[model samples]
Target chain A: MALGGDARVGEVVESSSTGFVSQSYRLYGAPHLGALVRTGGPCPAYGVVHEVATRGIDPSRRPTARGEGEASEEDVYRSNPQLEHLLRTDFRAVIVGHASEGGTLYHLPPSPPPIYAFVHVCVADELSAFSASTDCLRLLAGSGIAALEEVVAAFLRHAVAAQPDPQAFLAGAGRQLAALIPGDFRTVESILLRAAP
Target chain B: MTYRESSGRYLGVVVGGSMTRGVDVRLSPDCPVEEMALGQHVVIQGQSRRFYGVITDIALEWSDDSIRANPPDTSNPLIAGVVATSAAYAMLRVLPMLAIEGEFAMLDGPAPARTVPPHFAPVRLASEEDVQVVFGAEDSRHFWVGNPLDMETRVCLDLEEFVTRSNGVFGKSGTGKSFLTRILLAGILQKSAAVNLVFDMESEYGWMGTSEGTGMVKGIKQLFPSRVGVFSLDEDHSRRRGVSPDYLLRVGYNQIEPGDIDLLRENLGLSEVAADAAYSLARHYGQERWVRSFLDVSGPEMRELAADLNVNERALSTLHNRLSRFRRYDFMTERESDESVEEILRYLDRGIHVVLEFGRHRHDLSAYMLVANLLTRRIHERYVRRKEEAMGDASREPRPLVITIEEAHRFLSREVASQTTFGNIAREMRKYNVTLLVVDQRPSGIDEEVMSQLGTKLVCLLDNERDVDAVTAGTYGARELRSVLSRLDSKQQSLVFGHSVPIPVVLRVRDYGTAESYRELGFLEASEMRRQMERDADDLFGGRD
Candidate 1:
């Protein structure tokens, strides 16, 4: 029972105890890094997008490089008709927590989303509520996620922009991060300074 | 951004990872961290409890690591110059003040705990009320010494703890050690909790002394006229200061004791045999008349006396020669005074501070050591008797006494510390209501045992490693405090720590010569009232003229 505003963008392709990989519906609309994505049947499992990539689906097929002399941006895509079936986008999301009827719980989900389950972008409300606590940032920072600092910074900026008052939300997130890593002020300041408008 | 309402002055936020004993704090961009100083108290508001800490270290961390890692992009001079002054974060190392319970307790008051603050807690500057709770309130038992650096609140020391145990005021020369000692003496007098007998070595404590740059520094006697009495060994020097002596500080020939001779052994260059000869002559002629008769003896008379006493002849002659030099000091009277040791004790018992001015004999170590030791020995005996008599009587309180000795290392040094009465008082005087305020330039020269017994140490700048070690030895937080002590300004700054203060603190010592300082110490009121009374008396008596 996905919300009407939520759009399915991918399906689970691989799974692990810590995270899972999903293939996008097309070579476009790949979930942004640090964006929250959910996939499950009745009970929803949540994760933060750690990596997004697009490449030829076949291992032996290497796409020819295009120069900047293209007549128009869309002309290249229209000219390569085989790209639609040959290339695909995939994203990796580290499983952060799960949500039941009770509420959203912060921790490693009981299990990774099952294979082929549809993955939908978490709505703004859910993202805002989850970002209120710095537990997610702590999870991503401590996890074996790729580009950890960059991922955490992106997630903070996205959450701040999604809120009703971006400025207030950014300040709140700064304080939350400060409380999360009080001993590492250097990291906290780095993240907040990047998050600043 | 909407700033959250805070209960305290939000100085910064804890930003770094937790340390074993402390945490790192990133000062808020809006915070005036420039005004913050080391040792300033701060509190961090944790989730469940508050954490207290002091600013131990501060640094600036640049945000751009790429600028240093990669070569400068000199292709665009403007871009290179712009990146050079990029963002720098102010980072502080805060050593948390925890209670002994090992819980993250609030630092709003004076409770002790041993827990670190929760992450990202707002670090706030400690308020005046918090400082009062930590340092303690001003009362008869506590006297305000000076304010902490960069704080408006006053810092005080416990007067009772200060006078009950031996203490040291140590610094290199010209570091305002004398000024601080005078302030402490005034504090002790204000409480009237003890009797102080100051051995004024340079004649600084009894009368106004002149500083090369600052004119006419007031002495303790001038500050508290009713409570202080000045006694001088040189009457002409006292008259120059417009002060008449209370008793003229005369020591009768009988007052010379064997301990006094032993204390002066180094100064007189007497061999062990010569020192023993003086003791033998005392036993033969009796202690009272020995010095008088020995001074009158000729060479043949000394040899005859030496034979009768079974002493070495040459040693006896040397002892006679050394002991006769005292006759040149006018304070050493051949005849006894009607005013005995009991009279001085009586004045002390009534709570009057006594300053024994050395006057012209200030540089004569022999006279200073001999007189200080002899007078203190008699005073120590009297105190012991009084303490024993008042042992079980709840209603009787023995008058606590403080004996201040300058060049204290001379009397309490390694060689003579065990033999001097000052050393005994330094060790055992707390029980007898007597303590020593040992002042010295070379604290390293003082004996280890006596230095250990010092309850409170107010240290100014000391560059010598041994001297610094001597002052900070056996105290809590000595390791951390050593660095703070080393950075003290060469002028009027001191780090006062020990039983009197809860934690070590660095303070700019209070101004001594200002009128406000005098009024705060009650000196102005006491002196002004005395002058008014004198003017009235003059008007009443001179109208007939």
Candidate 2:
């Protein structure tokens, strides 16, 4: 219902029960990949930014290289203000869990974030409560999402800093992953290596 | 990281298990698996009850087989911590033996665990209270025998149940079998109404004996001198050891019989036919004078005697040669009466334990076999007749007797077990209120039937495969106990199970030989005994000179 000024990051451009797409107000302003983010609704849905992309808003027109004639990439963007309007940055966050009445529930929410709802990057305390159990990895483990291991690894890497004991958090996530991942431990171990501080 | 904590000894949770096959406990990630040793007790808190279990085995486990094929790189501290906690972990194989419910547990004692705890039930290292609940506390009727391995709580034996049936103490040589036997003997004397008749082959049960670590340890007699008496086969040797026995045991010529020679068949190196010939010799010379009359026959006299009995002369000569070795035992006499057996019986009649020391004849196998068999046969005969008489009148019931014998395999071997008195005592159990405490190093040499008849057995480390099999055969939970028995430390540790203890336990047999231990064993020092005497006199008479 309410949020901090710095917490507001973007508006929900696309919505689905499993995931949502958010377009940043400023170019390249989308939260870091795997950072946990929330959306506005009666029952707000939490998500992990699994994929990020910067491309032309209109699918028909593809932008050619304008950097070759400029002194630097910044000079091209300054020379053509239309370039900023034409291109956009969008992040696809898989709905890992949702906020509940008593506390955060590390499971899928009843409804997806509303279309055009404001997307807010979660603060440290929110990240702490969500990462405590690391139970959301169950969704990413078999979500049929691409680069699933990398997404889980990246989530652990960013979430550990919010934990009281970052090392213990990483280890807790590994164990949670051990129970969540249905395959060999090597898969879980490889992911852990990527998240090691 | 605080996955679970129950009184801070929490080790794991019951992941999976069965009533018959025990349970698999997934250890908490923070718990060090190496610290969980075999034979240590664990208590599991169930939904409505608690289960007590012993750690029979431990294993390294993974969520998958990849841990074995492609182990995690533990090079980094974070990776190492994660791998240790999650990727690769430990599992404890616990055998839940006893179950206790809330108020019922305090009243009825723990019952056998009939079922495994539910999934994810917390398992903690058994506290002193849990161990005490299962084993019971030391009191007037129970004796503190030892501590459970690595635990301070005393493991007590119900002396009432202990002396009710035949029991055994077994271990390889130098495993403290004799020392443990001394402890049990002292317990029986102090706690129970049963009287002991120990055939002290090494003279270790009377006065004082030498120990591997502590020289000159006090014997059962020294611990309870008023209740215990030493009867020596070699009077001079006993005197040299500073033990003036109550009686000097001298086996008369008339006391020796055919069956006594039969028990010594292996030790005397006599053939079956040669040993059997003694029966005919006894029938000829009369049972009273067979050993002496047979030994007295000369070169031609022996042959002529053998022919007269229709026996092979060479076989008779072999018997004579082996039988003549008994002459070197100066304890042998030509007296007309059986003095030693009567003396032992008289002492036992007075409710006093008699440890018949072999003295110098301790190393002589023939002497030990001859004296132990001869004495037990006469004593058992008297007990059977008295028991029969007592059957007609319960008031005439005699005090229960526990006959302790070392090198029991010789007398209870498969060949001679049917005939020897010791085997009969073991098999007959407590029918005549006469049981046995068989102490031996090689249990495999004993008759299988007698071993099965044993009610309680305390076994130390036995590396011999056949020996282990012999002790554990036909036992409940033998497969699981085999693991516990295999892991016992070589000395001062024993696996005690059966009639006396509620559940099987591995005990770190309490310290002995120290002055402090003597006090713990209820031994009053000379000054203390004097003060006790004064206190008793004060209670009896006035507090005056």
Candidate 3:
């Protein structure tokens, strides 16, 4: 059951135990990067928005620049209404934890979410409960994505804003990151610098 | 983080180590490492018992080499906090001293720690209650000498146990040796059943002693006037000091035995042949009159006298020159004086302590050795006889005597220990009810047997390696205690161990030279002092007042 104003951002197009990929219904309508988004099912899997993209629905077709003489970017899309149906917004979420019978568990879910599962952007209250403990940072840091540093920093910046005590949470997250990434102070320092409240 | 109070606060956990090497403790990060001090008493909670120990060493350690190569920025509180707890930590080496089973089992007191606490045993600072259970409370038999390092609890010495065997007071010069000796003597006088016969070589222990802070403080005699009898050898010097000593002493040349000469070999510069000839001369003229007879011969007849005595002429010449030194001492006379040994014996028989003052002869080692040896030999003989008689009738036993001698190395050195009566008293160890309180700076010069036999030793700062070794020799945990003993502050602090204390402890010696110290030891004002004298007399010889 989605709460008031909980955006129904996407539907799961691909799924696995570690993560899942979702496609938004409307073109260019995916949640912003690093946002906490959840899959809807009997057992919902939660993740951080690690990667997002917009591409043509057909594999052989490539989307090209069509706004050279347009007054604004909106005119190009409005002139060709068919572009909305031809393009798709999809995102890959790194699974940080899942909702269980007891509460949010900062660990991998036992099974993947069903394909085409509805994915919604999590509310501030729901995000606070998941980020209560920094244990989930280990999962995010070990995801092995090229943009891991930026993803962690951006996710912490969003999570810390929803926390009751932002400074304490930032410091706690900093120590958690410092310990999770062994001997890699440059990465930890860079993440801490950007995530600092 | 919460601040932990040090009074019995949980310090750390015993990590690893053995009995001989002592145990190592890894301090918790929350407990500040700076608060850990050397020689601080700590208690370890073991499986079924508790062990007591002292902190011997402290260290900083880490798990990863990368942390050291590229140190983390600890300027951030969170970074510093996490690093201190996870990667780096403080460690301590604690030498366990005593152990006890169950909390109330202290009635038998703590026994020497034979085994170490199991790994990961919780350790904490010894609370006041724990300290009290270890060091008994001060009472009539237990004298409060001072407080243990950095603690308010009293460290008491069982004076009765102290006097049962010979004890020693040792330190380098100006390390408060005299003041420490004075405190022990005052305690013996006030509390113990033993009577003291102090060979006051420095003349400081008789009427007064000077402290660096206090101008002049009262001595044992001044505190226990009626119970103490000050005997000076120089009547003129005694009068000048306004002492009016109870007895004035003068030893006759006949009292100088060959054994006394053997102890003064270095002081008199006597050759072996010369020193041995004194004995043969005694055999020729009899021991009672040999010294006077040998010194009376004219220079021209010296060779003929040597021929008649069957001694080398040159050795006889050396003997005569050395014997002449007795004549120059105003306290030595042509005829024996009753005021010397007889009066000292009378004072001892009545349970009055005798302080034999050297007066102007303090620096004269020859004079000090001669008089001390001569009187102590006679006293030892009387005690041996009285002790034999007491076997039949216990009432006839003389009061136990504690003979205090300063510069004791000169008397009890390995070369001359057998020839001196002081050494015999040290070895005999209350066999005839007499023991020694040897006071010296160079304990290394003293015989090993004598140092090993001293029942209790109060040692001050002695930076000399051998002296420190000699003082702590043959005791449990001597090796581990070396660092604590060496690092003591130069004054007022002392390391005490042996029979009197249950465990070895470093303490700040209680005040000795202040007027307040005198009052604390029961010294009285002038009017009350007179009444106290009368009261002591009444207690000793039955009331006459």
iRMSD computed for candidate 2? 1.8
Model 3 residue B317 CA deviation (Å) reads 3.4
Ten residues in sequence with the least summed lDDT for candidate 2 chain B: B1-10
Tens digit per residue, CA lDDT, model 3, A28-69: 888878888888556688889999999999979899899998
- Point to the candidate with the largest DockQ: 2
Candidate 2 structure quality by residue, lDDT tens digits, B1-545:
11122352888889997877789999998899878888888989998788888888899977677677776777877667877877578999888888887645756788888888999999999888777778888898888999987789999999888887899999999998988998898888878649999998888888898788888899988888899888888888988888898887787878888888888888888898899899999999898888888888998898789889998889999999998887888988885476667788889889999999888888888888888888888889988999898875867877899999898888889998988888889999888889999999899999999999999999998888899999999876777888888888988999998888978889999888999988877799999999999999999997985
Give each candidate's interface RMSD in Å. 9.7, 1.8, 3.2
Give the least accurate 10-residue stretch of model 3 chain B, judged by summed lDDT.
B1-10
Q: Give each model a TM-score.
A: 0.70, 0.95, 0.84
What is the docking quality class of candidate 1? incorrect
In the predicted model 2, the residue pairs found to clash are none
Better of 2 and 3 by TM-score: 2
Considering just the first chain, candidate 1 attains a TM-score of 0.86
Give the TM-score ranking, best first. Answer: 2, 3, 1
Residue B264, candidate 3: Cα error in Å is 1.7
Provide the DockQ value for model 2: 0.61
A1-197: candidate 1 lDDT, tens digit per residue: 22325679999999876788999997877888878888875667788898998888986978777636679868777877777888899999988777777676777777778999999887677787776665666667668566776777777778777678776566555555555554444565566566655
Give the per-residue lDDT of model 3 (tens digit) for B128-244.
667777788888988889887778888889998999899999999988889899888898888855899999988788887676667687878889888999999988887887788
